[model samples]
Target: MNKNTFLGITGLISCFFFSGIALLQAQSKSADLKNWPKGSSPKEIGTRVADHFVVTPHTNFGKPTPPKVITYPESCTWYGALTFAKASGNKKLTRDLAERFEPLFGVESKMIPVPDHVDYCVFGAVPLELYLQTNDKKYLDLGISIAEKQWGPPEGPRVKEESHEFYKQGYTWQTRLWIDDMYMITALQAQAFRATGNQKYIDRAAKEMVFYLDQLQKPNGLFYHAPDVPFYWGRGDGWMAAGMTELLSSMPKNNPNRERIMKGYTDMMASLLKYQGKNGMWNQLIDDPEAWAETSATGMFTFAMITGVKKGWLDKEIYGKAARNGWLGLVSYINENSEVTEVCEGTNKKNDRQYYLDRKRNTGDLHGQAPILWCATALLR
Candidate 1:
């Protein structure tokens, strides 16, 4: 062959080889977890959380400032990360988490008067799961202790009135039914039921779901933040959905409330489907298209949708696309360092819609981290 012709042929062969490799790489990036690579997989997100994130001791209940005692929302990240680690089948990660959490039990037991607030007890979900995995009685004891306290009447003696006082400073401890409390109280109760095989834990969890749905769920299937606050705060609704998903997934097959819970969850999901933004995320204010896409709510919805489809509770054809897109939206917020951004910070019920709209956004907050880990674990299923 002539020198010029030989050189041209070699260049073409090299170009084809590189192009073929590029196409193969692109093809490997499938939507499902079948070929999910470690770099961006749900497992990696759990790993990042296990390696980098620390559970903050701050308390968001009843006070703006950090409290001396560790609280339940703080444990949301712990439960999420540990649950993800267990699902990933990473023994070292699980052991590391167990060690990390071991000391907290003592501290929790010695709290001046063990917290009476149901919100304070939410952290028990982690201990409950840990007990089930390792068969350790201490973990079970810790969880049961919290459950026993939360099982009683509302904190104050005035039951009906206190329950409806959404504006009270001690609403977290009171009988007040805010949308956020659904997850805070129910998640731990579900865990308690799993650990003890007691029907009461789940019964309370399910009945309370019905109660909240009647009080807060609107005509469109979305829930108001609270009776006092009329806005459909995205995270507030997300909490309700996440709680219902967890309870229904674990509730007994013959439980009388299963059908009711199922209906509520499906209805809320239908409403959520309509509000999801084009970017695969839900808005901070779900009904308000003008609000920015929020990560925590998106993560919660993605986890719920995927869980429903996998369990046959939701129709795959209808809800699967939204769930997968929601997963993509959540991971997009997770940076290489695994710091999730654009999470709406801890919020309280306020009278005006602008209060929820104007709340500050946070990064790597436990509120956001837990839902992302939950979504990651659901995708694995």
Candidate 2:
């Protein structure tokens, strides 16, 4: 070979060699464990939660009503349990979660959600995750279809001009600035990115997040229920926190939105640290000391903090202490039945503060349970 050809081949080999080394190093780092406090250790908690998920039948937000369609809460919980199973090397769990989902393509096919809304579209993440673990083409097709539908032609009642306008702007027809949509939209697309190694999925998610951040996030780094609603609802903020975490986890390093999204994420974390109750929980009304401590938001924020610290985005010593306390504080709310308590019931935007403060506090709510599982999954990763 000529000298030029030899140098080019050598350069290619060097690139592959370094890339492999980096990959191994990442795997090794993930494999290493930190000594965790009891009940807060990811391995213990993730496995326990994963096992619980396998036994739990699909329910509509943990209510008694027959849930004809799968919901975002169940989808998120399923995805988290699946990841926990994969991370911990639990083959039995991997099988159990996968088997649990297989029916969606068969007997329970009718139960699959229609991707008309953000909540419905997030369900795609679960099948995408299953595809990652099992290499099932059926799962891939189902998930990609759902994810694509989010950005596809706006369907359903054509009453709203906003849907058409949003679609015209190259956004999901379902685009609404609701804090919950951040997680709903991000989960599906981020998982698609992971499953296919596609930059478009992550790019779309990051762009959507930046829009939400610009439109909804406040000077205090928390989000109101809507642009008009002034209250800082805990779980709503949790959705934004978790959404940002998911998007950031998958976004490419050179993504144009990376800096802005990172800034928004870090700013929110700082505010969360300041507002965290002395017991390591965030209040139902995040900024309201009078509001009761809510487990769901605490769990979501804990997950985000743990992820940030793990990824070296935050000060380890400072955020680590806070994250540990958040987990333990969160776990304290779990009853013997394994249900989470003090979860605010499903909420809607209201201008009145008492409406939020007086909202029913639910026991054994999936809103609460899902976030705890997310925290456990973050710890494991």
- TM-score, model 1 to reference: 0.83
Q: Which ten residues in a row have the lowest lDDT in candidate 1?
A: 166-175
Task: List TM-scores for all candidates, in order.
Answer: 0.83, 0.89
Once superposed on the true structure, which residue ranges of model 1 sit more than 4 Å away at CA? Answer: 1-33, 54-67, 106-113, 153-174
Q: Lowest lDDT 10-mer window, candidate 2?
A: 24-33
What would the TM-score be for candidate 2 when compared with the true structure?
Answer: 0.89
Clashing residue pairs found in predicted model 1: none
- List residue ranges in candidate 2 displaced over 4 A: 1-33
Instruction: After the best TM-score superposition of candidate 2, give how far the Cα of residue 377 lies from its true spot, in angstroms.
Output: 1.5
* lDDT for residue 186 in candidate 2, whole number 0-100: 93
